[model samples]
Target: MLVTRQKTLRRFWYPVMPVGKVEAGPQPFTLLGEKIVVWKAADGDVVALADRCPHRSAALSLGWVDGNAIVCPYHGWSYDGSGTCVRVPQRPESNGLKGRVVPSFPCTVRYGHVWVALGEPLAPIPDWPEEDDASYRRIDQFYETWRCAGLRLMENSFDNAHIHFVHRDTFGDIDNPDPPQPAIERLPYGFVARSDVPVYNNELQKKNLRDDSAVTIRHITARWYMPFLRRLHIRYPSGLDHIIVTAATPIADDRCQVVQFCFRSDSEADAPARDIIAFDRRVTEEDRAVLESTDFDVPLDMNSGVERHMPSDQPGLLMRRMLIELLAAHGESEHTRHDAGRATQEQKSSS
Candidate 1:
């Protein structure tokens, strides 16, 4: 059941952290509600595995790395990067040492972060900021924990309505009653929205401080891979030369972890990368507060069927509905019956 619930996050490789974060030791973390341990072998390969030792169920991360193998702290049992049990202390004659292996996940490092696919590979992790594009520069990348499902958070980020209201102080004006209505247009792979008005009152918007008249627009692209893995592209101040924000959100149900990478022109050497990170974190915290306030205790079925949506909510609503249809068709195949249980629980509660 847990495996099925994490299908989307597992099937596709997800960037967990910058490559520098996980060194030569076992780093324990959780994703999609499953406890996992990540470690870099001496050979520079990254490995992610279920954290528990197969023998005494001790945390594998509590052990030490012996060469390319992880030595369990409890009984000296060791497992290799492929999760194969390579050694067992004082058990040379035992058959358990032969093919016994631990569950393992595949991992790779790209764009400066470590990525792990929770399950068998569904597809190669797509490259971003496409390699040949000299106009792009790696601005920032990091992980954020939200006490809300990743789906809701992603939708909220792409949501056009919240910009005019929830972000009135930073991204919108205080008394600007006549905010320019956003225009959303569908893109080949996802969607885009544009506005030629200044919606933010931030440092970037102050007339003497920066170019406040720079038309602020946001272009977004969304692709869902189910069990809650989403790829989103957000480009701000449309018509700029590839100033793009790409992110992947893996939903761990009520809590989601997002890995975002921001890009700017490579020639723009004067851009302050840390400042951009701080700015994004500020907006993200605001979004986190709003998403976490939803009635999560309510069952999924009730939340699914008993909600009212405004006209401004169309884009998010459509995306969610499309996900629902996709899951209904592939849910069982993906072994995501637990989501159905949650949905049914909500259905009954709503009744």
Candidate 2:
């Protein structure tokens, strides 16, 4: 399903960009069909609001930041963090534009990403424990837009059977096409699946382990949070732990911005960050090429038989079921449509 077509999906916080990049001026981002800007106040508080300027419909991102307000480029109007119009260049300083405001969203920083919710959030931002732990080094790997839906990304991450075919160039091998079945467990936040996948000990593994073993088993514990957050923890024979966290933030109906980061138990001396990133980048590229060539959206209603299924598709099947349940519980009502219509009218009138 198209996330923007549903009101409930907009209520979840989605990462837009890395927090370190939110500097200088308002940076424009597309989150759940909304053109929003992320900037920092003089006091170092992160501010997010609609990218539109109320006076003349200019993009707020094109303007510069002055103290805690973002100045509009078209008419010199400025708005504060709360989206209240604080200054109007065309009018007298004494007269405040009381009713002039821009729509705003809840913004915060977590896991080195700027998360913004287009509407009232249904839950807090999902936590990644290694971010606060001192023993592990967290590396922000990649932040790029992919031509695939968030569900497809999430589904692919949890699918293990594809390793033999989709990733043959990287780490897949026929020596052990499949190792073990995943043990699925439900959680309050989402779900967890534990399995051991046999894989060829590629260059990445050889460097990390410092051994030239032909093959190895990846004891993986996969976790999925509501919406599109994933964590895959893999344990190697040498007691090396590799934890990868991926977030797929919906940008539009057929596109998603993916933020991938990882945590390693070894120090920089043992495993270089560059090597890890390079290997994962290639893996992701393989998935991207195939995903882009296929369907863009995931079929949420599994009963319609929109696509074929197999026994190995259990992870993806459960993913669809969970999202379907979310829709059944919080589908858009008449009141939501009315509010959206009113918001559209207000925007048109302002323009």
Best by lDDT: 2
Candidate 2 per-residue lDDT, tens place, 148-189, comes to 888888988988877877888888864556636699998765
lDDT (C-alpha, whole model) for all candidates:
0.62, 0.83
Tens digits of lDDT, candidate 1, 11-68: 6566666677667478877776678888888787888888998888999988888888
TM-score of each: 0.78, 0.91
Taking all chains together, the TM-score of candidate 1 against the true structure is 0.78
RMSD of 1: 5.1
Question: Which residue pairs clash within candidate 2?
Answer: none
Residue pairs clashing in model 1 are 10-118, 171-199, 301-346, 301-347, 302-346
Worst 10 residues of 1 by lDDT: 295-304
C-alpha-based local distance difference test score of model 1? 0.62
True-structure lDDT of candidate 2 = 0.83
Best by TM-score: 2
